[model samples]
Target: MAVLSEEQSMLRDAARSWVQEKSPVTAFRKMRDSGVDVGYDADAWNEMAEMGWAGVIIPEEYGGSNFGYLSMGLILEETGRTLTASPLLASGLAAASALVLGGSDEQKSEWLPKIADGSVVATLAIDEGPHHRPEKVEARFEGGKITGRKTFVLEGMAANLLVVSAKGPDGIGLYLVRADDGGVKRQRLQLADSRGAANIELNGAAAEPLSGGFELVEKVLDRARAGVAAEMLGAATQAFETTLDYLKTRVQFGQVIGSFQALQHRAAKMFTDLELSRSAVEAALTAIDNDAPDVAELASLAKAKMGDTFHLVSNEMVQMHGGIGMTDAHDAGFYLKRARAAEAAFGNQAYHRDRYARLQGY
Candidate 1:
């Protein structure tokens, strides 16, 4: 486990308090029922922005605190506990990291302040298919214009800017494409998670390329994968705790189910896996913050471990709860659905496990 500094602890506590008081699982249910196209509460996002949550990874000169990636992960972990749906991960961490790491001064000056202030939402427009495949991009950039389709863009419909990937003459490159361009069209995706995601069609839209080539995509994606692992850690922890509480109280055969040896063993395994997963997650985030050369390896480790742990815990959350877990009225279903969506987001267990092996020269 990574040791938290005084400020890091404070940030985690503040994030925890805010999520519990302002945005809980109930809030998520309400958002789903209300059919909000943005997939989050606008007022709540503004509140987070005012608290500087959106600017955690952005440099101070760019209107952010530049606290670092680990700090942002802490906030993400807290928010994940309640299953809060927001663009914080997409715009705040993923999109912001692209700018912080590779954005030209002109690009930084034009977009970073708006991102930090919550005035604009941005997200990556990569992956042309249903699965995560950055290296297989068929989109091409020529003559300062990009034409292609991007699917499953997180917070896509709400974004004002898209950090797009395409085949440049120099090789694969990142482009800053405006959503408001006439050539751009968006189709909101109604996912099982009910989050804000879209499929985009860019028809010869003007784009400004970022400095880094394919290498930069890999770097930006590492940050994204690590952040997702942090959020998964928070959700998995909560699921285990909630299930453990249910075990302690619910009676089966005239005794608390906690007395059952089989259930006790299952819970114990989950606790152990969660602890190990936390170590991997914190290590990955810390690696990014420290600019470690082995970041890709750690990222794969973190995401794969977190994916397996979350998949196990979420399945057990439903199985352990018995009947209530299967119903829409219970929050177990929410966790289960979220697990499926998040597991597939950046890379699933199979994907990351393969990546990890390849990185290790297997």
Candidate 2:
């Protein structure tokens, strides 16, 4: 198991408590009723920014905490538990990652400050089609102009900026494109999880090229996938815990169902699976943070294994809770929805499994 420093542990506890008190499951229920896609509670978002969560992996020079990836993982896990929908992951983790990994000094200096203060929301638009493969980026860049469409961009509709991937004469590249650019168009896509994302159409949108090329995009995508895996683990952990609580309190057949041998065995298996997923997620996070030689391979492994764990844990959680679990009024369904969405966010289990095998030189 990976250990956190005292301060990191304290920050994690604080984040957990803050989310529980300020943005509980009831809050999510309210957002669901309001027909909001992102479920971004402004007050809650402000509070998180105040606590420096928006800068979890940003540098100090950019008015950020410069905490590092582990701290970012901790915050993401807590957010996952609540099924909180916000631009935090899309902007804070994904966009910020692209900037740090590939942005020029001037770009970082200008953008990181706004991101740290929550004034700006950004997203990485990498998938040019339904297939979600970075290598399949068909967006074109020529003479400082970008032209193409990207789909399934998380927070794409709400983003102030977009880090878009494209194939240029120099090879594949990343470019920063302002959301309000003349030729850029965005249309929201309805996702099962109710998060805000968009299908973006860019017709010769102006762009500023990032410093690094294809390698930089690959690195940032790996980081984003690893982050999503951590978020999935967090969601699975909370789902298991919530289901356990329900089992303890809901009595059936003259006793708590949790006490029944069959359900007990199921819960035990869920726990084991959850722990295994946790270990994989933690390993990926650590490897990415340390720039370990095997980061790519480990990230793929974590995503593949944890994606399966998320599906199994969430499905069984709903099963254990019976009819109420399937109802929209219940919180268990929210967890299951988020699990499904996160599993497919960057890539699904099959996608990661193939990537992992390739990385292993198999």
Candidate 3:
């Protein structure tokens, strides 16, 4: 029911066109064939930076475009359509959220401009394991030195700056640590999606404490969850569209499988699921912008629903495409792989659903 403004629509359309032209399925195939782990194209990343995609949600004073979260979501959706590989989710959204919510003036002045310009890659290191419970953080900071291990850090191997979550004397705090710090070590994790991540080992790594306390960390997590939900929605939307296109073109025994009643019904159901997921994602974005009291709950709900939607839609997309969907040669498989990875990226469906239920006092 929510309508984007004219400018917003234009921005979304422009991103879509750029992705289609520059970062198409052929590019993904090439990356996969070359055994590239991250699947990122440097030229495409620069193009995105030039188009202000990196600064969509950053404030104006920070050299960003200052568009807001909705615009960021729109761009994410377009990126999903192509399965374009980049650190947009980790650097552009997660790191930016942390900086906006908790960084000091000096921290902001030092990092935000570089991030807005895409000159630096950053990511948040919070999950110490497969289970993402920040409150259970065991990473320790003592005397301005951090020592701990963080697992499953998205884009961890590539980030220039890491906003690390640690247990301070008072409570949880965000610490800014440069990746090149002497005591820091990063081990690349070979994930199923071909996206880059790592396990970071910190042994007395020098860190600058962020300004806020646990409350600010919680707020940043909320924003990060909302941003991830938006990205999941993008993946889900792309999966549905990809399946729809395949159904229309691929012939069956006599005609296009899309014309069959059963296939049509399945497509309709997938579309419905996609729209429902979109509504939840949009609600989360609005809650974030307005600082709604239920923002956390809405974010969990959106993430949970979109996680389920992505799984169902991506699986269906593959099934509808038959054997070709399982082969790496087809674009459908790429979307499926990305969707499965993203479903578990920030939090899986059951994880967020339980969080949502707890938030609702269930």
Candidate 4:
């Protein structure tokens, strides 16, 4: 486990209290069932912003606390515990990082403050295909216009601004495109996790150039991956705990299932993996904060490890609960769905495993 500063500890505790009391799994179920176009409770997002969570990484001059990556990760972990649905990750962390790292002064002045205060929702519109291949961007930025389609855009339906990756005159570059542009069209996707996503088609929409080339896209993506790994750690931990509770209570052959050696071994394995995953996740987040040269390597390590653990724990959770876990009424199904969706997001275990080895020059 990572050591926490006084403020980070307070922030985590407060987030825990609020999520437990106000935004539990039950609340998530409600939001999902409502079929909200935005895919999150607008009121809950406002409350999170009001608490300064949306600005955890933004500079103080831009109306944010400038806490850094691990600080934001702590809050994300808390939200993952309850399956909270919000644009905080997409807009607050990912898009904000792009601007902070590569945006021009004018661009930062326009978008950073709005993102910090939740006045606007902005997200990265990269990955033109099903998988997260940032290097395969086919989107074109020419003549001050963007043209191409981006698929599986996080918070796409709700974003006011898109930090888009496209091939510019100087190789692949990041551009800012307005969501409401004349040539933009979006189709909402009803994913199993019920999270907000869209397939966006941009046909010569007016675009504003940001800064940096593909390297900026990579730096922003590394931050996003680390943030996702942190969330996976929380979900995997919670799933294991939930399964453990079931094992302790569910009886078979006149004995508690947890007393069975086979089940006990599984539980031990999950506990060990969860602890290890936490270490990798925190290390990745810390590397980002320090701007460590090995951030990509650590980010891939964390994401791949956490993805494997979450996959194992979520599956075990369903199996341990028997028929009840398979039902829609039970919360186990929620964790399973979220685990699969999250595993695919940013990158899956397979994807990161390859990336990690490549980073090490293996």
Candidate 5:
């Protein structure tokens, strides 16, 4: 396990307690059943902002705590543990990442404060293809207007502002567009985990250009992957923990299944996998914090490893739970569904594996 500083440890503890008490797994089920348009509770988001989580990575001058990305990752891990559904990652973290890396003074002055206060819901619209392909951004930007379609945009259904990527005369550029602008259209997607997403089509939408453009887009993408990897780590750990609890109490063939040698071995393997994933995610977050030269490669490595590990752990959780696990009434299945969604979020294990190899020049 990675050693945490006093502050990060406290943040993790506080986040875990808050999620458990205020918005546990049951809250997610309620939201899904409620058939709400946003698919998340507004009260929970405000509570998170009140807790200073919304500004965990933003600069203090801009109404943020400026604690950095590692601090943000700690909070994400806690949220992932309970399958808490919120735009904290999609809007708060990912959108904030783009602004922090690329936003000019005027842009930051106007948007950061609102983002920090949870008043403005923002998201990234980078992938312009049917899948996760940053290189496939073919959206057009001409004469200060954007025109193209982006798919699988996280939190796109509920965003008021969008950080869109388009091919400009210079190169791939990042442009900010108002979600309700005249030329924007969105179609909500039904994800496996019920986390909200959308396909957006932009037609001659006016935009404000971020300073760093493509370079900043790369940085933001790596940071987003690292954040998602941390969340996956938490979910995998939780699933393993839940399965362990079930094994201890569940009876099988006149004995507790956990007491059996075969079952004990499976538990041990899961524990080891979870620990390995923890190490990779922690390394990636630390690399980003220090501005390490190899941060990009580390992010890809962590994402691939964590996604695969979570897929493994979540599957085992369902299997170990036996028949009850297959039923919708059981929470074990939720973890598996969430794992599937997250695994495919930024990129799946296969996508990142290829990315890691390319980064290594293999």
Candidate 6:
């Protein structure tokens, strides 16, 4: 088990209480029904910035807390419990990770402060295909401009700055591109979880190169996978807890279903999976914080284990709840939808499983 310091515990507790009180699952329903252009609530995001969560992983020089990735993961876990949609993971962690690892001194000096203050929204646009493939980048950058289409960009529609990957003359390179520049187009995608995503087309859009290329991109992805795995851990655990409550109180054949041996066994399985996922996510977060040599493999392990567990727990959530679980009126279905979308983010269980094996030289 991972040990938490007093501050970390306090941070986790405060985030849990705030998310449950201010932005629960019902908040997501309201956002969806409102037909808003943005998928998340802006004021809620500002509240998070006030909490200093947006700068959790950044250095203090840039107005950040320099608390590290584990702290950020804890906050994300709390938000994920209630399915709170925000760019915390996309911009706060992922984009910031890329900039911290690859950005030049000037680059970091320019953008990190804005990211720390929640003044700018950013995203990493890497994959050009249906899935996560850092090495398969075909988008071209030449003459201080990028030209090509990037798909499945997280928070792409809302991000003002994009850390993009393309095949440069030297090799695959990372560049910062402005979304508002000429020849830039964004088409928002409607995802299962209703979290914002988009396909971005850059035609001669102005760009500035970041220091690291493919190597840094891969590292940034590992960090992203770990963060998402933490979120999945929280969501799966919440679903399991809610379902367990139902099983205890819900009656069948003139008795509480908790007394039935079959239902008991299913609940036991969910509990086991949820606990295992928690362990895996915790280990991954620690690995990142320590800059462990095997962080990449650990990240892949966390992503695969947590993603599969969430899928199982969510499916079982609906099955155990009966027909009402399938309806939009029930919150159980939303958990499943979020689980599917999260499982597909960064990489699915199958993709991460393969990556893990390769990392282990299997």
Each model's lDDT comes to 0.94, 0.86, 0.84, 0.92, 0.89, 0.90
lDDT of 5 by residue, 214-233 (tens): 88888888899999998888
Pairs that clash in candidate 1: none
TM-scores, each model vs. reference: 0.99, 0.97, 0.96, 0.99, 0.98, 0.98
Ranking by lDDT: 1, 4, 6, 5, 2, 3
Per-residue lDDT of 20-100 in model 6, one digit per residue for the tens? 999999998998777666588888888888888889999998889888888989999999999999889988999999999
lDDT, model 2, position 148 = 96
Candidate 6 error regions (>4 Å): none
Count of clashing pairs, candidate 4: 0
lDDT digits (tens) for residues 177-262 of candidate 2: 99999989998888778778899999999999996899888888888888888888888988999899998999997998889999
Q: Provide the clash count, candidate 6.
A: 0
Mark the regions of model 5 whose C-alpha exceeds 4 Å error after superposition: none
Give candidate 6's root-mean-square deviation (CA, Å): 0.9
Tens-digit per-residue lDDT, 1-362, candidate 4 = 78999999999999999999999999999999999988999999999999999999999999999999999999999899889999998999999999999998888998899999999999999989889898898899989999999999999999999999999999998999999999899999998889999999999999998788999999999999999888878778888888998899999999999999998999999999999999999999999999899999999999999999999999999999999999999998989998999999888889999999998998
The candidate maximizing lDDT is 1
Show where candidate 1 strays beyond 4 Å.
Answer: none
Q: Give the TM-score of candidate 1.
A: 0.99
lDDT score at residue 129, model 4, on the 0-100 scale: 89
RMSD of each candidate relative to the true structure? 0.7, 1.2, 1.5, 0.7, 1.0, 0.9
Q: Could you give me the TM-score of model 5 versus the true structure? A: 0.98
